[model samples]
Target: MPPNSQPSPPVSPDGTTDEDAVLAVRAGKGDTAAFGALYDRYVEAVYRYVYYRVHSDTDAEDLVSDVFMRALRAIPRYEPRQAFLAWLYRIARNAVIDRARRTRIQISFEDALAHPGVDQIVEPDAGLLALADKETVRAAIARLTPLQQEVIVLRFVEGYSTSEIANLVGKREGTVRGIQFRALEMLRTLIPSREALA
Candidate 1:
């Protein structure tokens, strides 16, 4: 709101706010400050999203940079029909997929179960015990099919609704819900008992 200052937060209480839409339009028109605002707003979420998929801090950092670079170039053609976050997330998703395909990074589900940084994926507010639970949960999520993993991450970790995820992933709402359901069921089966984690 101030002259030559960083733009205010793009999301309001309801999530995607009008400010996001307005700044996105300005950024599309070559407004550097506006684009910076969008970057500041989304960089962490995008990083976390990428980190969850790649399980490497270095790769996630590189891909986050790539996602923004691509977004900056593509914003000029972006329409305001969808929430800016949705569009941005789609970009992040593609970046992850592309990186996976290009590098052929493969870690089996059992390998992820042994991965030490699983707590990194848990929400920050979770308690120590909750972190353990989340670590177990995250490992289980890694075992899911790609579609199921996307739906679960978007719905639970990133807090997108079924419809929002549907739009981002180009799946029907019912299909997203189904993926989420099956993913959760798999997680329940795969996660350790609380006592085991403790």
Candidate 2:
């Protein structure tokens, strides 16, 4: 690798690269550039995960900011038993949960289905069809249970693996797999038979 090559991407959280141990160590020790690099590496995935869960650009935006803030605050004591992204995601997930709890907010799955713009949660007004598609996908994701929703966001949306999810959520790998299966089943079952079957 070139001496000036860009930093390596964090582990897949699926058990691939393990460089997060090093990057995270540096970050935890007060390395702003390392943290920035970490943010550069995972911002999109983290934002997408929060966007899918909250289903509102306004909520997701605030939540993403909170997640990063929490991560920075918690970084000083971070332990690397899991991939850094997984740890960061755990923090992000907690922020989402906290936001909902503190506000006593109840986001209805049905409402989310009816209003897909919630998934565009981060301002997806690129155009009509694109905006529509974001809503549709977000609505589909809403059919899942909250746990499944988190898993999906971490797995598919954030590209984590079952193992990484296991660490992030403090669940066993088997549980994560089961959740994935059940979430997919619920989404399929709720959709039209043609779509489900096809």
lDDT of each: 0.70, 0.68
Q: Looking at candidate 2, what is the lDDT of residue 65?
A: 87
Per-residue lDDT of candidate 2, residues 57-137 (tens digit)? 898889888988888888888877656876877788788778867987665667656642332223212122232345655
lDDT by residue (tens digit), candidate 1, 135-191: 455555656777777777776677776666766776676777778777766555555
Which residue runs of candidate 2 sit more than 4 Å off their true CA positions? 1-10, 13-17, 107-133, 189-198
All-Cα superposition RMSD per candidate: 9.0, 9.5
What total of clashing residue pairs does each candidate reach?
0, 3
Q: Top lDDT: which candidate number?
A: 1
Q: After TM-score superposition, what is the CA distance of residue 156 in candidate 1 from its true location, in Å?
A: 2.1
Off by over 4 Å in 1: 1-17, 108-135, 196-198
Highest TM-score model number? 1
Sliding window of 10 residues with minimal summed lDDT for model 1: 120-129
